[model samples]
Target: MQPKKNSIIKTLKLSKKKILVFIFFVAALVASFLFVLKDIPESATIGANNYPQSTKIYDRNGKMLYTFYTTKNQTFVSLDKISENLKKATIAIEDRDFYKHGAIDLRGITRAFIYTVFKKQVQGGSTITQQLVKNSLLTPERTITRKIKEIILAFVVEGVYSKDKILEMYLNQVSYGGTAWGVEAASYVYFDKPVERLNLAESAFLAALPEAPSIYSPFGSRPELGKKRQLEVLRRMEEQKYITKDQRREAGEFQLKFSKIQNKISAPHFVFYVKALLVQKYGARAVEQGGLNVTTSLDLDLQNYAQASVAAEISTLERMNVTNGAALIAKPGTGEILAMVGSKDYFDEENDGNVNVVLAKRQPGSSIKPINYAVGLIKGFTAATPFVDEKTCFPNPGRAPYCPLNYDGKFHGVVQMRFALANSFNIPAVKMLKANGLEAMMATASAMGIKTFEDL
Candidate 1:
């Protein structure tokens, strides 16, 4: 009986060993399948084409005066192009164990999953590589299948790219509010300079933007939340030994100088007109999304002078009941518009100040007289040819006779073509147009770059 009992126990132990061996074999098979998946080449390249960059608009002098981009206002920069302070701040705030972890942090994921499942709290455990993979290569739908793909792609990206390269890609691909993408564009948008010029405090502020760009944007309604996030980044940096406590405190107390809001767009209306032209030429999608570089004939110095002059003139004209003014200066030879002032102020929404008068069409008033007289001169009417600015009525089909009057409602009899156009005598200009014929005058105006005229 004792021998039989020992035999039974031995048999049960042998069965348990077989089950454990089978489990180990299945685990090895699953891992080998995952390894095969990782080995398969993916189509997405880690290159500059990952995001749509802004087509920088430069003045003739090569000064970047404006930028054009769609929703994802990305500007790609290498890791070395940014400051070390910014890099450290990003690592401190985003992934404390970045260098120490592999492609994924199993321990952190476990902890986070446990907290989420049981404690009703959520936490992130993804490494920097994971984030890069999720943002650049995968769709944003949160699902088990997508998560699995993210992990696989993260491992694959880690296998292909170095740690530093991955870190740089993450920095450049992340959004930082408004139209800003990447650290360089964000630095310029927030601080109006390159990332290399950022201080510890500014770097901390920027590092805080990636999590919630619009929410933490300094221009948003909750600016204090942005400051709070910035302070948290500084605290993390100090805790991680990237900065000393004193350095962190100093940075925290530093008065952050954010670049003035979106209004810094120089020559706003002119830039918009250029954008419209580009859209017409390249189609809206290509101009907005193709990352084109446009060099224009605009002269910034001239534009500044013109804007100043118009502003001064508007101040004086306001007393004369003129609430706004616009000016355009063009090179006579090339017809290149050198300067354009669209309105008295772009922000004065009450007066419709944002409306660009240079592009708007109204009755030319006496301005059309020059074209009429020029046509008359081209058709045997010399500058000395006589015309009378009298109260002569033009025939009307269904209404009272069409009579034109001068500014003073009095006519100067016997005016030459030059005098009629120079002093803008209304009846003489109308007679000149009639003599030259309306079609001939319209053709002459069209030849002189006046495109707004129509048959109506």
Candidate 2:
């Protein structure tokens, strides 16, 4: 009886031990669930905004002249809206288990650890959700706290939204470089079309670019480097069976085309100017966060006309080996900028695109004679005032005797203010400045918007 009783007690103890283990496991799982529930906030439900307010520039005609942005707008489209090849290529390139994973992929994490551990290096196992979390809510600076926050937020996002919604958020919020914030913007910049129109080869090419945008842009900037990276994306797509071997070959050798934003008709200089102003107003962060629609004092029709005039002048000066011209036209009465043609092309850096030539100090030649006439007007010299033009000298500043002559070296003796201005005769004007003091002529120049003088 004692031996049988001992056997029964042992069986009961084994059953109790199994029950205790199961209870602990269930408690741990429940505790984890409760903890996750506590950490998730309502704000984590929708996609978090990471981009700053971008500044826009418009012409008088209400056309968009330029856009200055730190990070550009991301055009978000539905999975159903985008091409099938695009969806496949992006999945193949980024995360294959994007749909199955709940914000984080445990299997991927384990596999990555196993592979990289043996090789003695760290490899990223971040899912698209984790990446999105990092991009949206957290600072890009790598740190333990940031990582923790990212994980928490990603989990919250998974709980709140559907897989397709998450994918849309990721696609729309991703940075594709060159002032382009999303895949759609990148597509338009690279292919002059929208995401829905992206072909298989094009889709693969775009998916490949995100790894290193500066290096792998399809613009043939670093063709060898770009081609290599693009090829890698294509090969990965094939390996993942997103595309077949035939598709991969076709993609690998496809002819790529790129458009130049630098050569746009929009005023690039003015765009930069507005961007600088936005940076001043909202700080650098505003360039991404502000999303400002800047209404500038620029007039498009007047700008075009002014540019045409400068172009005409440049053509005339071609024989003199001059290839540059600039103009700044202000509203006749209000001094508002009617037009400003910085240069011939939007990105003509030599012009720095905005010389604001009206504000530039140039060799006055005979143009400054009018300022002296204005000075004479201020000094009680009437509009019908008269002055004698002769060889005269002011004995000061160690200057030479003034024998002011016209461009043809012809000397006109006696001239009235109207003749002096209309003909631009210099002797009478110099005499007037000499008589009225230098400040008087400078004041007159200031009144007329001539701020600097390179002529004596």
Candidate 3:
């Protein structure tokens, strides 16, 4: 009977120890909760000043022609500008209970922790707000202190910003793939268009990029993995009721047409020239990060055609030892540069394709004859007037005698001004220049937009 009593007393002692341990656990949890709550701000503000955004270069029709950036290629667009499908897809895949969660998804964190610790399966428990806090304000280093701060900051951010605003900030701040940051730039880099125009399938495809940008990039070696991720996103969207069964099936089966990788700008020379002009006008920093939306008078279609034409002509001219060529098309009336082909191929390093031959100085050959004869006409020389075209030598003051001959090697004894100018007769052109006077001819050429003879 005494032994039985002693056993009961031992049982009571064990119960008391368990109760104390429970109270200690509860106290510790409350203290941690208070610590996190105290650090959270009442309000939060997100601004573009936090990072550098690429200055977008667009054609007159609002088509994205090129982007100028240092490292990260991003163009921020409002949440309203993004496609509804993309928003739904992102939420469905990244965080289903994003709207219902407070600052942190406790359930998701618990599950992820269990999976990471016991199951050895890595999973992210971060909600979109937490991700935004970590990506923008904090460093990428994974630590207990950083994570705690992220959770606290995310809670503060949600309280300050509306759900729509928070989602908008997340969409704009997240990296899509490669160097693409935000939906707008990703849309252009992937679909070659605006983010608002993306379809359901495209949206799903893009939503999957944030998981592992390089690993799921269509341009990368593992394109199939990207496709699989996209399908998973669609499945999640369907499960969330954001998309119907048929819609998910159709999106899953949709053939994705990716935009060709534009490693260089469409019109490299023209774009660079525009960049230089912008830099001159708005300093380097402003041009790079001031988010200047530049609309130039370039006709992209005509420019492409002109580039193709130049490339074709270069191929044909290659046999004649012409390694490269350049072409420029401009309106005679308005002087609007319609197209500027700097070289045959901008990537052709062997031929120095980057050099703008249109700006290069070379002998004008017979091209200058028109200007000289036009000056002669201004000096009262009529087209019907005759001039002797012969292999004649004119006495020079200091230099050797200036001899001029016909290109055909046979001189026509007499030629009319029209025939001389039209046929580009060198001897007649020299005489016309002499008649007009050097200073007057130079002034006439200058007035006609011949910049090469400025010193002369």
Candidate 4:
């Protein structure tokens, strides 16, 4: 009787403890719900233009170079104006379950949480609605509190707006690299066409950019990566049944011709160089949207003259297979850039004219002969030092012997260093390099501001 009575009391005590735990859980849940509810923003104000003002760039003479803006470049279009292909492509790549899920994807969030905690990889599980809310209403902070607020606002926004409205706003508010702020702007920027005219391939290409504008920009460094990303978007679209397999194959094989940048700016490469510096100093957000009035040291008159000279020279050299040229004029005393022409023409995309060749790494060819001669002179080799410019091979222990030949494929025997340098003889230069020692030449070049050479 006593043992049975003790068992009954133990069961009653366990029931009381379970009830208290349930009550505490419920109380905490109610408190958290109320706390987050107060932070939710008004969903009706989502369409309001809250973007910052444009930053103006000017030359030293106060002439406007460019008006750098993210929002200023935006051209908002109705959802119907945008291409259906682009819409499908965006949905396929960005969020496959956009239509099926609510404001937050619980399953995706759970998976991301598992990856973050167990695999030690932080990942985002934001739905389209959540993204719209975060980009429009919240700061770009990666914090638990901020994420909680983003989730709350996403729910409120979904409740107030339909899915179509949310998608429309998102397409308008998202950035698509450079000064492009919306799909309409991106369409024109990349294809030189309206958003409605983007075909399946073009639409897929643009759809790939919003994931990372700088990385996936066709005009950016490593453009092959952008092509790879476009193919990935097409793959996703096919997997989700948004695009057929044939359409995916065709789109993947399509050659995309990007439009030349058409922003109204003077000395575009110089302007961009200055903008890059500014972005480095101030954050990208501040430089693009902080309304900064930047005055550079560029002389517009010299810039125009240099551009004309380069164009004329390149035209003259066209028959010689020279398709491009660059020029940089600076004040010799102060080293301030008076004019900088990065290429022969900034608008010639076919010839890769947008590439700033002045900054590119290339074999100096005969141009580096002067540096070689200078290093030889420093190492006690006089101008009259005689080098045999005959057929000779420098020995290598494990590789083929480095045999150098002159540009004209004829050698002049026993030439002075000055004459060999003047004529730019390859054999004499190689012989001089061998005598001067590679380490000694590299040290001299480094001191003379030749930065491209790596440690041997």
Q: Which candidate comes out best when scored by lDDT?
A: 4
- Candidate 1 on 313-430: residue-level lDDT in tens? 8898887898888999989889898888899886779879789999999889887888889998899989999998788999878899999889988989998888877888889888
lDDT of 4 by residue, 162-211 (tens): 89988999998888998787798688678877799999999999999988
Order the candidate numbers by lDDT, best to worst: 4, 3, 1, 2
Tell me the whole-model lDDT of each prediction, alpha carbons only: 0.84, 0.71, 0.85, 0.86
* Model 2 ranges with Cα > 4 A deviation: 1-5, 23-48, 71-155, 158-171, 175-179, 183-265, 273-289, 301-305, 321-323, 343-360, 365-371, 411-414, 443-456
Task: Assess the local accuracy of residue 429 in candidate 3 as a C-alpha lDDT between 0 and 100.
Answer: 84
Q: How accurate is candidate 1 locally (lDDT)?
A: 0.84
Over 4 Å off, model 4:
1-27, 49-72, 107-124, 265-456
Root mean square deviation (Cα) for candidate 4: 17.0
Highest TM-score: give the candidate number. 3
| Collision pairs in model 1 | none
- RMSD of candidates 1 onward, in order: 5.7, 7.7, 6.7, 17.0
TM-score of each: 0.73, 0.60, 0.81, 0.50
lDDT of 4 at 155: 82
Model 3 C-alpha lDDT per residue in residues 1-456, reported as the tens digit of each score: 999999999999999999999999999998987875565433344544457888988766776678888777888888889999999999988888988987789998898899999999787898988888877877788877677878778877887887888888888878987788888888889988889999999999999999899999999987999999999999989999999999999999999999887644778888888888899988999888777899988888998999999888878887789888888888789887778888898788988888888777877788787788888888888998899998878888889999977888879879999998888888988888788888887788789888786453
Which digits, one per residue and each the tens of the lDDT, describe model 2 over residues 1-456? 999999999999999999999999999988866664564444453465434434556676667675555535544556677777877777777787888778888988886798798977555688888887776766678866567667878888888888887877777777776767667667767776768888877888777776677787755466678777678778988898777899899988988776675524465555566676777877876665566566778877777777778888888988999877677777777877777667655455665545544435567767677677777776788766777876665565557654556555666777777887787766777777787788777777777776555455
**Residue range with the least summed lDDT across 10 consecutive positions in model 3:** 40-49
Model 2 RMSD, rounded to 1 decimal? 7.7
